[model samples]
Each structure stands twice: as C-alpha cells, then as structure tokens.
Target: MIVYEVFRQERKGQAFAHAGSVGAPDAAFAEAYAREQYGRRGESVALWVVPREAVAEIHEFVDELQKNYHRVDGYPLKEKLKEARERAGTAPPADR
Candidate 1:
C-alpha cells in the first residue's frame, strides 16, 4: 500500500492544516507530487511530506447525540433579543 501526507500553510503565522492525503511510492515522489497538487497556481505557501506508515489517520468521531452547546449558532439570539427589547420597552425601528 502507498500513502502520502500533505500539510498546507493557509496564511502567514497560521499553522498548516492536514488538508487531506494521497497514495504514493516514496518520500521524494510524494514531495514532487504534492508540491504540484497542493501548490499548483500558488494556492498554498508550504507543504510537508510523510510516508503512509509514519502518519496516523483519525476516521472516527465520538459524537453520539446532538452537541449544539459547543456551537455559537446553537443559542438563538434574535428571539432572545426581541424578548429583551419588549421587556425593556426600548425597541428601535425595524430598519435601524
């Protein structure tokens, strides 16, 4: 089996994110291949090469139910704001 790891630099000072993976024969091949695949048209600033065996893959997520509490959009703010405005009696125009 052949495997290749790719690390991409999103922007200055930003750590590279493991965008995805591909299969290749060796390190040199992976580097030559990845530079083109990831940086083609200069989309990325940098990349790292690693063998398939050297990389660990995480494929499983432990979420067994809804986990909205960890999300910002989880809490409905518009309705709460409207209720607060009504209670405070300081609501402004719809356009404002």
Candidate 2:
C-alpha cells in the first residue's frame, strides 16, 4: 500500500489545509478513501490527494548572521526610557 496525503478546502475560494493521510494501492482508491474520510459530512468543499512520496520535507533552516534586531530584547528600551524620563524631569525618586 502507498500512502497519500490529503488536503481539504472547507470553503470555496479558500486555501486547502492538510487534512490527513490515507493508505491505498492506487490513486483512485486513495482519492475515494480521502473523500469518505474528509468529505462524507460535507465538511470540505474540495479535496486534493497526492502521493506522500511526491511531497518534500524541509527540516533545516540557516541563519548564520545571528541577526537579533527584530526581537524585542534586541532594543534597550528600559535604558532608553529612563534616559528620556530623566531628560524630561519626569523621573521618579531612586528610592522606589
């Protein structure tokens, strides 16, 4: 038996999401199984059945530069806020 991946679209003009998988001997049976499993209740407007071997899996991502500016901790917001408050004479007493 060959494994087939099923994608389902719940509404017209919408993107298809990964529904599940079905194992069958051929494409026709795989499609039928997918229809019975995913579309029997009319939950999916459309179905796409593709052999699992045709799909590619991506596991590795490269980020060699170590860029951090987009993260919140990358900016010294607390220090900058303190400096701004001091300059504006709105800083609270250090005892607090």
Best by lDDT: 2
Candidate 2 local lDDT, 1-96, one digit each (tens): 999999999999999999999999999999899999999998999999999999999998775776668667678789999999999999999997
Reference-based lDDT, residue 44, model 2: 96
- Clashes in each model (backbone N, CA, C under 3 Å)? 0, 0
Tell me the lDDT of model 1 at 50: 72
Residue ranges of candidate 1 with Cα displaced over 4 Å: 57-96
Model 2: runs farther than 4 Å from truth? 12-15, 70-73, 91-96
Candidate 1's displacement at residue 72, Å, is 17
Q: lDDT tens digits, residues 1-96, model 1?
A: 478778899677889888677677777777788888888878788887777678767999776776978888789999999989988998887795
TM-scores, one per candidate: 0.53, 0.68
Candidate 2, pairs of clashing residues: none
lDDT of all predictions: 0.80, 0.94
